[model samples]
Target: MVTSFLLLAGLGVLVVATAGVSWFMLNAMAPDVLPAFSTFLAVAVGVVTVEVFLGTGLVTLGAFLYNLSAQYSGGVEIAVTEALTGPPPANARALLLMARARRRLRTHIAPGDPGAGDRSSGARPARAQRETE
Candidate 1:
């Protein structure tokens, strides 16, 4: 119901806007030619009517198709797990900051660079890289 109402409202606004622009353009080109306001109102109403019927039909069709598919393929599976509750460790903030800084700093290393550390492994000791630098 909510989806249908939203779809109808959105498309109705679009149709009305388009009709208004067309009416404005036609009136600007030739004033007092056709009943432009009435025509614009008619077109907007007609389009919105068609949109409501088609939109509702399509939504129903989609729902039917989804139900058919779900029967064959077990639908979506959601897993829920309880979070661990406790006060964080004393050095939690410092530890997290160090990890974040290490990640950001690691991006500067080049592949196969001497004393940079094994690419397959991870960062080498500072003592090893200090002499090379």
Candidate 2:
């Protein structure tokens, strides 16, 4: 989501820069027609603004709908495993430290997982765990 916004902002900046250069050249070539260049630049900016808003809206709507559906149907699951064939590298100590930190940050259950609320076996739900902490 952040990437999408950054990409659109970059595109807008590029379009505006290109239009400014074009306007400068047009003014130099035909000073009398500067108004036309200004109008063109205005229209281009308007179009880009509309495009950015529309794209952001669609992406937000899609995410919202997906989250709504995922609540009823369990979302996707992925399993990952790391394999090392050779001996660890010289930076193995740093890697191990980072790995340990990441493990501490990891969440066992995803928010949409059905098992997330199960506390029958003495495991507290996420909210309860946080409240106790």
Candidate 3:
């Protein structure tokens, strides 16, 4: 209970801070770029901040519900393979597979995924040596 309250409060504080910064930036911009930039910043801040916060909330909620259910049910566990394949056709195994596959793709795009970009494991290409030929 207390933890959940704190989590929500923390999110509220973050949203306020982001909104404050966005407001300041809008006010600071000169008239020429103000309108365009302010609009852009407003949308960007709203999207990146709110959407991220919402996603965080959803993940937290999922974890919390899982824990609560586990506590009551004496625990529940599913193998990764089973989770991906689901039960059977009547249970919509194909839909579960597709959703899991999409989630795997989404995870690769998350913050620290190595394959996020085309960079070769953070290794830079060496400078080309002059050919003697």
Candidate 4:
């Protein structure tokens, strides 16, 4: 009976470990998910950061769907093609689509985005603080 219990417990731990590894792999493959994951942990430790979880989630979902579609449709490089092409000059539709993409990214949490911070005020906070003092 003791031997049987030990076997079952080992099996349970093995199953849980396998599940944890699979979950890690899935998240690693998800687009923009790492930033959100780090942000969540930071928030738990009282650090505030804009992660744009909804935007990142949507992007990840889209990437998942795109990968699924590629498996069915002989694969296509959609994101890379869009970025490298920088919108087709002759096609108004492509330009319009690119414009919308730019606007969406601008409003969302894009890492290293220069326009991310509020720039209406001419001076940065440190300079303002010095002036006030």
Candidate 2 — worst ten consecutive residues by lDDT sum? 76-85
Ranking by lDDT: 1, 2, 3, 4
**Candidate ranking (TM-score, best to worst):** 1, 2, 3, 4
State the number of backbone clashes in model 4. Answer: 0
Off by over 4 Å in 1: 32-35, 75-133
Q: Compared to the true structure, candidate 1 yields what TM-score?
A: 0.48
Clashes of 1: 0
Residue pairs clashing in model 3 are none
What is the total number of backbone clashes in candidate 3? 0
How many clashing pairs per prediction, in order? 0, 0, 0, 0
lDDT of 1 by residue, 1-133 (tens): 4577687878898888888888889889999985859776887888798888888888777777777887789995332337865537867887888999988767666555665765456666564576689
Give the Å shift of residue 56 in candidate 3.
12
Q: In model 1, what are the clashing residue pairs, if there are any?
A: none
> lDDT per residue, candidate 2, 1-133, as tens digits?
5556678878888988898898889789889866776687888899889877787778767777877777789975332237746545757887888898877645654566444556576676566577789
Return the top candidate by lDDT: 1
Task: List, residue by residue over 32-123, the lDDT tens digit for candidate 4.
Answer: 55545445444433311122333345566777799789989999844534256544677978788889998885566445644346667453
Predicted structure with the largest TM-score when compared to the true one: 1
Residue 105, candidate 3: alpha-carbon lDDT: 64
Name the lDDT value of residue 13 in candidate 1.
85
**Per-prediction TM-score to the true structure, in the order listed:** 0.48, 0.41, 0.29, 0.23
Question: What local lDDT score does residue 112 receive in model 2, on the 0 to 100 scale?
Answer: 69
